[model samples]
Target: MATVWSVTSPHPVHPLAWLAPHAARRRAAGLRRELRPRAADEPLLDLAGNDYLGLATDPRVIDGAVRAARTWGAGATGSRLVTGTTALHAELEAELAAFTGAEAALVFSSGYAANLGVLTALSGPDALIVSDAANHASLVDACRLSRARVVVVPHDDPDAVDAALAARTEARALVVTESVNSVDGGLAPLHALHGVCRGHGTLLVVDEAHGLGVVGPGGRGLLAEAGLAGADDVVATVTLSKALGSQGGAVLAPAAVVAHLVDTARSFIFDTGLAPASAGAALAALRVLGDEPRRPDAVLRAAAALAAAAGVPAPPSAVVAVVLGEPDVAVAAARRCAERGLRVGCFRPPSVPEGTSRLRLTARATLTEADVALVRGVLAEVLTLVAAP
Candidate 1:
């Protein structure tokens, strides 16, 4: 008798298999995404990363990381609830809450995890989540994972959020939005949304990834600038990766909400704690920002200059998006800038909510006048090259 073996078919019969065709279409449209790592000593002028304050590699930040690593081990051994929580984590959380003017704060491994922890922990089957159409992918995924009735309202439209909440009479409601849109660098109408949420008795969660270091007095964040930081119904999630130039995130809210998350948020309970080094670095960066109040002004000026030179409108925050009219055009423009020793971000569909492809440039406080001139020149050449045909 011959031995028999079973073979499985590679193809699936479900409609989801059609995703291959969609992916191929995206490739044909030059919307394929790829990552290219930079060399440690790369000479290129970087305008792609979210290091708004240019402190990621600062000497003080590096020293903080070194000190923390020397004191604590490199990796957190377990989830924060178990053996992972350290004195550094507690100190960072306390300082962050005080700095952001919130009653309590919970740190997570990343901003994505922070969003997930907050949305999933606060909302459930009986909750209605009204989200902005232009929100980050993390928030969108959180809404989906929360098992809540999610209504995606028009981008930055407080009236739409109000109507959505008004229609949901009995459910616990959450209004979620980004303080500064990642793609276009446009500021959201946070004040108006706060009013809408207040009227509807809804909890408002603001993702301040881009707004923290570039907006408000002393770079406190959009919520602080809008005078909503300590509001009982409002919560904020922010990334330490951007302005803080670290590698973690934090959710700031009322003490009760923070306590609730510690008990109920699966992401917080199961995820490994943020590295001790990142916490120390972020704390040092925050202190530096507090001492040097003129950093945000420098970033804003650089952004304004770049926007004007690229023939794009100035961004309200530190990001300046240069529209290239089409997907292939945007890719080509970004490539040209890269070739010219300038690194810029290329945004296409899916990443861009409006489906308009553009080049996303992040302005840094450390960018000098000469660096700004180089950026202007490279952008001018790339735009001209793309526009020619």
Candidate 2:
């Protein structure tokens, strides 16, 4: 049986006509994005993911998730402000706050949402946001959504941030930056930036998405390493997906600030709470890290070994990026590595704000010395092939 009910269209349109030009443009520029499926048991050397501590596949983490699902079901059902807050959420929040040395913490669905929640909730037209030029896309989007005056300072330049903050005398000021940049794997001078923010009486919002679990004591993060953790005017956002090797994000600040976010953060109030399984997994991972303090060191060692072998500097965190000046060359080099059974990340514009292209590699604690040697050999061969004659 066939039944149809249709309404008249206002204008005629070709379904594939609009997409053709965009597709052509992408193809010509070698910017087309495609999805590649990975099988559960597929054999490949993994280096592209953000699993710095390699806890994502840990037996304890998996067991935690399984237990949580069996006990709490899969979904949280509604917004946290409504029916979503669970004991697991409360436990995770408490543990994260203590682990990071924050007075309080609030968990969100993802790090992107946590940034959005904090920026949008705290700043408005009357505020001025001074941001690093190389901030993550989430922070950039947060600034845009805040409806505040945004001043983008030079990347990792404390003087630039100070100047921007000083220029905005009449408005409430906020300094936004990433502790460890995702693209080039550069580390921000957090202590210097904090001093500048302190002098200007501005709130320093540090995004430790890449730094957490790979820096500071027992992977406490950049803020703790800089001696800024739990400061009255300092706030930090971290992703549970990376260091924790689970899921979700959190904003850590003073108790009063967290209270304000609980009442005002749109993302936390409207979005469904994080899944119980992820919360459980994150909790377990955190516990494991706390018990086994050398995991972070292992990851950093692996990254350093790979960087040394490649004749490139190791990143401040777990990321080790090998610079390849041209986009096409970087892409080809990454493809060559992949062909040799090694998986790596190819970062090009607009992912890299500096306009330089590179192959971004992440080092995991689970990566063996043999694995590092294999990756180094593969990357060296690929670069040799891609280098100009």
Candidate 3:
């Protein structure tokens, strides 16, 4: 059936007339999204957000943001190259580099921007990019923007990456993968992939968005865990919004690579600097992670508990995915969970493959035994309800 238009414009058709049918298709497929504004003190147990360390509401982190706002105003005002660069941004960059063991770091407005900056600045028509099938959307978009020859290998298949790099015709090459798969919470084979990249003389760029605050010693990320941080041929992009409980992202690499991106990365050169408040919050969060190194372990433990409750394998990071096989079923399960006073993530098509829609439950260091029990009961009932005919 044709979608009816409610437009009253004089023109025969609106320029955006195609949007009606597109939206209709999405609604029919149970793929439409709705925004549910959260109350400041909503009393639901949260397992849906990416606050792996639960530092977003911490007093110290809040203080850091307040101080930054008082000292530097609200927004960055202009691009970093213009009037946006502040002493706080520089300090955060240096601290991030030191903490992650990178030679240097460059901050961007967001993790998406950081990925765009690095990929576009490092690769062009003459370069080949080998990307993992399960990489985050930002990296996928980055590859598209790079204008490079891109080949997507199977998820976590280092041999496929090796073959792709070995057969590439371009003089320059980059292998991009996420340290942890965002959908299934699977850890990538970093060491094996890095070895392949080294053999092929390719640079390895790992997105540590999910790993920085939830994996490795003191949450230094999977690269650091694999002893690959600061390697000459390796680069990493991390989001302060995740484990750091702040906003913005950064690229950590050799000094030369950082310098090149600073000069040529359009995403960084043209975008406004990260807000001073975000820089301060991220810095404070990093310090918290250092002072309380057990936080990451707590995250992993919480993830394990959630996974066990959901009947899934233990996750290596804070993301615990429960595959439910159908979008509607997953949505129903999530709704049931919410009704039972538990909030969990429901991922459907475009986020995960069709027929594999699932619940994406995240872990937080602050989750308690009582919290786990609630999750267990809610999940058990929800799963049973969904499984019934």
Candidate 4:
């Protein structure tokens, strides 16, 4: 165990010295992260991002962003209540609600803020929040900050959710989960969970950050696929950064919930609004998705193919997790892939479960047959290296 002098002791150490032991432990455990920046023109094939629809570099999306920046300037200028909330932001919200079959929508600067906004706004003194154990970090943070009675249940277990809801002493309860888990490609039982919510008169908040633009008919989202869109008790949050290939988020819910969020939700009221460029890009991507309805299927097909190449089961979304038991093994495999001109994601330590370090490979609609072959070859070599003594 590491020892430290107490602040009230005769000889107390400096305030920053406590961080040294934490840093040392992280370094020894291979959990220290270097926020490395990559050059735009790096010669590497990317399987590391959440750009499922491949719109990040689409000419139409670029044109939309450029036009918005030219028209509205680069920044949101201030919080939405102040100089922000442009016509483009309102347009994006309306389009998102219409496309997802929701009654209303509200935009935020990022997905993390959207999650924080809704949870903090909807929760109060007599509220209960039941969260899934494998929920995304954003949702977890929201739960912690909500000031409500929180219970963490098993991953993908509707019975657990129902039990927690039934046992809650608070009359108003909210169950939180991700439509598709971030670490692996496992999906939550949204329909079943919704039924529990309805039965217990609770609200279900699904984070569709990983599902929108990748999981429904025409990529409307998982809620639409489950026939739960526009439901009174269901609220969904999604990031434009993922499938839309932009840089913001939105909450899809009933008009009443949206209105309440606008009035409250400190994160939304205080934080800078979504940039006009991101809003325009997301709107264009939504239109492109509507025009090219086959984009979702293309993403699913690519994910399935990559999973087969990795000798793994087909995942529900674009993420195909290659689990390597240790951080060292996972990092080694990622480096080997990079050496072969392929960029794969390395997830280790607190990002995932203790023994579930992995390579999080995302498949895009734009991947060609040649690109698929190259990825397969690189992954196969990585697996071999990881398996060797």
Candidate 5:
């Protein structure tokens, strides 16, 4: 005989009570997160932010934001299909396409939305999506929401992608990958992936979120560096938040693909347009990149210095991950850095895999020699203390 379970409480239980145990479990696992807001002018040396080019505070960028706000108001006011499409948005889209060597471009409110828009709009039930195992969270979520058969191959493995594409029976196929791995700072083999994609007659989607303003010649992007930009079968997505030091995203693809996304992408169709201020700021950032072509080199050099200080391989992009192998250790190390007047990023699962929690240090083009030296000293000291028995 089986015993039947019954609620003994006379009143109804709280609907959110079930979340308490999960929160406790997270605490036990050292994965509970908290928000710590900073002041506008904190004295700490910041190495955790994604402002790769350090243009967020540039006078030109700020002026661009102000100008756009004055002209078009602070908000977009409506979706792109409605009243949200401003002249600034059109100009930004045109410039982005020209800079990245794409036939056209479509701006979104964020990089996440751009990923979601392109993936969901391009693939469907009868289509197959080949994704890299280490793709960003946005790409993973996009794959899940695409309603397509998704096969996640090993990270940076073109042969695995080729095999997956070869084995798929769907009439249409899409291969999505990140040009740079956001967590580990690994570079994808764009040329090889594109070759495999061409062989399979599949569309290649490269997320240049971490690569756009830090990789390629003159910060065009990884796709442009590989000579695949503007290819009819290729598409790229980028965020204005990272190296651009702005706040938006755009999809670079053939004109037809942009048209398709504008029509069919639910994220784009239902979501509000990118803010006018963000569009203006991004446009100004692009111009700054054009004028200051060496900014990307500065970022890479800083990343190399930081990686050497951490005794890790030089990262290909602005992100330098120093793995400490445990969430508590990473968190404690970050806290120690903070105590030492250095602010860095601490990432734990599910941001990274179990046992690979790390300090995610971002390099900025504006980092002075003194700043780098101080960072080196602090990293050496903190990492040494953490390694002590």
Candidate 6:
């Protein structure tokens, strides 16, 4: 016996129709982003990237990545707690903990994920999060996902943080901030903030993404430089992509915190582990940083030189922001830099406060005197051009 049936498929819907108005609004606001993939060998004076130690293209780092890929394949197959965790990942974690002077460490696939993982895991319905207004977007998202009461204090204001923390009725509070304000290139008052947190019985979480490659002795990072490393109450998260010129992030904290994260951090528990090549490259880069301790100093010197040439005060880390006042003006300045074969970063509204759009210049340890002079000269012209425009 046979049976016959008639079937029909439903009409499809346009999935992105609602995005048209949103995209139009963004365009009107001068916030539309365009992707421009860089060439492998673009000849330009570079200042946009966060390769603070200039290790991204180093022979040793490249060799390490190549060796790792050859040994462990190209991708991490599963989550960290599953088939993804490799010997390379474990070694990298150990080395990072030792280097940062933390009792223990955990690694994530990216710095953004690390921030999200740590903040969300540490905070809950019973906790409060006092965060700096100028922290990275990752931390902001983390706070939103934490399901904790979040109080955002003014940028670099430790007193405000203390006040927020003191006012909280929660049993647990976490004070979160960046070692260096990413956009403004301002250094945080970590010593004062830590003091405030300690007095309030709050734990401090510092993101050292920028500071790790360009600050402290031998690029051990600002927490270590501030003598706060390995402190039971302070935890630090650093990105391997910046100074190590690799990819991934690590959280350095007490052993208990590390263990707890291993058990409960959803991001780490579910996300694929960091690729072996990144782990290998990071380890090799760490060794390189140890051998070339002067690289961080070189980066700072370059930042100072860039700031001086721009007629601004020297920035604390490798980031130097040149305020251009308007989105179009900042866009013009960045365009001028590109015209002059200088690749610089252009950040507008949302990245910086409204009406304070600017060019973000990052210093690399390998930049030469000639490169510095060229950047200075080009930026001087850019400043004048934007001023008149």
lDDT preference between candidates 5 and 6, better one: 5
Error of 5 at 194 (Å): 0.6
State the weakest 10-residue window (summed lDDT) of model 5.
3-12
**CA lDDT for candidate 4:** 0.92
Over the full model, what C-alpha lDDT does candidate 3 score relative to the true structure? 0.94
Which pairs clash in the backbone of model 1? none
lDDT of 1 by residue, 1-389 (tens): 98464546575365476899998998998878887887999999999999999999999988888888888889778899997789999999998888888999999999999999999999999999999998999999999999999999999999889889889955699999999899888999988999999888899999999988789888889999999997899999999999999999999999999999999998899999999899889988988888898898888988999898789888889989887667888888888898998999988878874457899999999998899889878877878888885
Q: Candidate 5, which segments miss by more than 4 Å at Cα?
A: 1-12
Off by more than 4 A, model 3: 1-11
Tell me the lDDT of model 2 at 318: 89
Model 2, which residues run further than 4 Å from truth?
1-16
Clashes of each: 0, 0, 0, 0, 0, 0
Q: Tens-digit lDDT track for model 3 on 127-232?
A: 9999998888899999999999999999999999989998999999999999988888888999999999999999999999999978877889999999998999
Model 2, span 155-231: residue lDDT tens: 99999988888788556889999998888778889899989998988999999999888898899988988888899
Candidate 6: list runs displaced more than 4 Å: 1-15
lDDT of 5 at 36: 97
lDDT minimum window of 10 residues, candidate 3: 3-12
Give each model's whole-structure lDDT. 0.90, 0.89, 0.94, 0.92, 0.93, 0.90
* lDDT accuracy of residue 222 in candidate 1: 92
Query: What TM-score does structure 5 among the candidates reach?
Result: 0.97
Q: What is the C-alpha RMSD of each candidate to the true structure, in Å?
A: 2.8, 2.4, 3.1, 3.2, 3.9, 4.2
lDDT, candidate 3, at 333: 93
Task: State the lDDT of candidate 5 residue by residue for 313-382, as single tens digits.
Answer: 9998999999999999999999999999999999999989899999999999999889988899999999
**Candidate number with the higher lDDT (1 or 3):** 3
